[model samples]
Target: MLALLLAALQAAAPSPGPAPSPQSPSQIAAEAPAAEWVDITPNDLLVMELAPAATGRPRRIVIQLVPPPFSAPWVANIRTLARARWWDGTSVNRVQDNYVAQWGDATEAKPLPDGLLTGTEAGYTTQLDQQDSVVAGHVEHTLTPPITALRRADGGLEVDPYARGGVGFVGGFPVGNEGYGSPDTWPLHCYGAVGVGRNLSPDTGYGAELYAVIGHAPRHLDRNIAVVGRVIEGIEHLSSLPRGTGALGFYERPEERVAIRSIRLGSDLPAADRPRLQYLAEGGATMTRFIAARQNREPPFFIRPAGGADICNVPVPVRAAP
Candidate 1:
């Protein structure tokens, strides 16, 4: 009887399959069907033109603002700033190595540009309050299984990477949300993320000063600062700037700052000049495969895959629209 039972157990065991082939993230993205890509709307684009230094070539940086239902207030403020040309004369005042490159009225004394709606600052505070209330109300709310299940279904495993609950994307921007079910989500401070700079008071920042993450992802700043957008193109213009010699990456001398010629909404520009961009759609089969590829590095560069990917590490791919 014991011999028969042992033989039956051995027979019941499943046969192992061949090891899965390794794929680079680029390959996975390239293999994604065209239907999985989404075009970036002009309304969501901020085209910033910087005054040329001795280089004589004005740098054009394109930033994609987050859509509504997340960071709406701050987004509104940024749009207002752009529309009012608030950043037209502002300059890049700080460039910290492996940190952020900040730009705005370094003096912080410039009056809010004309045409900005009255009580804009108050509106920002109110919106933040509303967002916080919503988050608080849903703190205990839970539903659905974690993203691990989805990852598993896609032949991948969750390594619990990133400091946030579950990292994903909303409207093309990488977002950190409360696991599988909750609505609590915030834009992550990944490399090239553009955030509003503030003072000691959280509500003080009214979208005047903005900074881009130039180094490692500062996950600690997530949800703490108002991250309104991400640099979709020309990040090298800011990232490759000279590092500041002053404290906190501030240029010690005003002469060292880089000037901004103008910051315009892409929609405000002529159709011929508007940037045509497309980003890989999130929450699709292609995105899943891309994330998996990132999590599992292939053999040439990595013998042992980390089997995990941080939200910041997996930047959503963007390119000029073909």
Candidate 2:
């Protein structure tokens, strides 16, 4: 996993927070979870169990998610599980220069056994039709000061402004949640981000096979599909794979393509089999230092300071289970 994340490594540029638009009664009530969400807001550090069953007592991991806006926040004691069953037959579909790395079974392959979304909701299918869709439509628009400020095409993720797939950021993960109203949220080709290769049809992602972004953040693929997970560690393994010569970056030689041994959810594994992981809740000293360090470039390589920082440039560090 670490190898893949390093290679693939890789959003919510929405309206400014602090003053939520007066939500309707239902909307207000629906926000209870967001409110009760254990306050994972940026800057705050909360410890989450890497694997609830990994140990007799939950093995702890420590890391901070750069508060609100930065993608790829700091991580510690986190392990990427072996790749899981994704759109099985899908192959890497498209790869553009300094843009994105996409994959799917464009050959019109069928989903491998035991790897398809069973229903419209639940499981990793995480339908955007919930309280907060993956990419909220309003947030996509309403580019205001300090909000929606990420460098993106005029239209948001609904349609690829670059006329590719889509591009944008959702939370810390760079994605283009296009067609978000009807709620079309799929993974885009963001560094370290993952996507199930598919064909022209949207529903092609049966979650049997998947791919990780090997290059630049492909903003054009935003909101185009569902992005279930990301490279928490070892990103380089997938990213460094030799470029494929087939239709969509497919390896010209079979040996060139990295082989997938197997994939299973950490939760599904036995106590002994599970990998440890911890997602640092946002808002904490870790982030404070990170943000400041990023803004000023104080590490002292050259002595030039950025004066300001964009959400994309910062990365949340991931490490071993503490």
Candidate 3:
């Protein structure tokens, strides 16, 4: 009876399976079906043309604005600025090493152009004044609460391997969570993230001056500043610029700054002039596969896969629209 039981137990044991085939993030993305891709609309696109300086190559940077419920005030302000051509004459004034590359009217003397709608600077106003404005026939921009973190089955919040807090995505933007099911959600300060510059006051930034994270992800700034959008294309143009010499990476001389030729809303451009871009749908099957592949690298080059991935480490792939 003992011998028979041993034989049955051995038979019940599963056989070792073949190792998972090595798959890179690019390979996984390429294999994704067409339905897994999302097209970017013209209304959400910002096309920025930079004049060529010593580099001899003109730079064109494309930014995709976030949808409503997050940073609505700042997004509206940026659109207003673009329509007024407020950034046309502005320059890339700051490039801090291992930090951000900022561009705008560095002198801080440019007047708010005419035809801008009200409530754009509501962030800088007193709470009582803001309430009064809303009550007194002023149209208020509605901001949606974002889903920033996720709760686990055990009633604890999930934490990524990098320990940067629980992270997720909303409308394709990476978001960090305060806690599982928390009402507050803020965009992550990942690479290529575009943020508004402000003074000491939290609401002082009016989208006139903007900066892009060109170095390591600064998660601390996630909720402190308004993250309007991200650089979808030509990030190299901004990231490769020379580091500024002045305090906080401001250019020491006016000539050191790169001039902005123009910034136009993609919707305003002709069909042929509009930028074509598509991104992998977040939380979809394709994205899941890509994330898994990145987490556990099976390639021979990697002797041991980390078996995990950071929020910033997993870059959402983007490509020209077909």
Candidate 4:
């Protein structure tokens, strides 16, 4: 099973595509690991809820993704695999500033005594934002990802077929599409988004591996990877890690990579595990106020507003229920 999974992952992103658009090498880092399913739909049962720290007070945060003139968001529910299981929380291990903030076991640290998957890798893997694809022989999963983003200032969104765009928000999710102006919704690979991991192959993952976004906006990657979810909380932990000096920006030494205490699904947690929380409503009045505040942030850092905001700059807001 592990051998088959590994082969499948290699087939997806076979180290060849037209010259990558000038998005960023960081785009490569934001790349996703493979999963059994290429698509995440209403049928797939999953919902991401932010769990707070020892502080007791809910670690409230505003998701920085939705477009302006809208701020408050609502809670979102993702379909699970029908049957439920608990997944634990993993620690952030690698940190590369303005690039990515990653955490999880590189390979399953725990060796399955008899190899449960029979032929597959075991427990050292944890979920991060997106897996970085290497140039030489590294493979990526084949994803017909659908991006949802706001059109450019001219009312036209990214139309280049080599890339993808539709530009919009769903709940707290950022997405894009293949058919322009059509009703298709795939995942968007915005900064800090989370996805499963795989080796140099496709469908070789089982949703255990994951990564996070931490750099430039890599829009061209839409519909090309499996976007599981975003880091609804605790980004600072990963973002503040030391930068890697390695070629593809990996931590130079093993010790530099952070550690994962454990990573599990919120559902898997005990009754005390469920954290009380609420996401700001995109259409709510508060969102409208927040949009204006960011779009025209009179911050001391800026002497001038870019006068326009990119979809990547938008923040999906979350806060404790008042």
Rank ordering of all candidates by TM-score, starting from the highest = 3, 1, 4, 2
lDDT of 2 by residue, 76-175 (tens): 1011212333422333344444433454345444434332233122221222334442222112222211122133223232333532333333443443
Collision pairs in model 3: 69-144
Maximum-lDDT candidate? 3
Q: Where does candidate 2 stray beyond 4 Å?
A: 1-111, 118-189, 201-204
Report how far off residue 274 is in candidate 4 (Å).
3.3
Residue 308, model 2: lDDT of 50
TM-score of each: 0.79, 0.49, 0.80, 0.54
Best by TM-score: 3
What would the per-residue lDDT of candidate 1 be over residues 149-224, giving only the tens digit for each residue? 2243345434434423555565676666544434455667889999888877535477788899999988788767
By summed lDDT, the worst window of 10 consecutive residues in model 2 runs over 70-79
lDDT of 3 by residue, 225-271 (tens): 78888999999999999999999999999999999999999988889
Per-residue accuracy of model 4 over 34-81 as CA lDDT, tens digit each? 221122212212333334444543432212222211111111111121
Considering summed lDDT, which 10 consecutive residues are worst modelled in model 1? 134-143
The superposed Cα distance between candidate 1 and the true structure at residue 66, in angstroms, equals 0.8
Q: CA shift at 289, candidate 4, in angstroms? A: 4.3
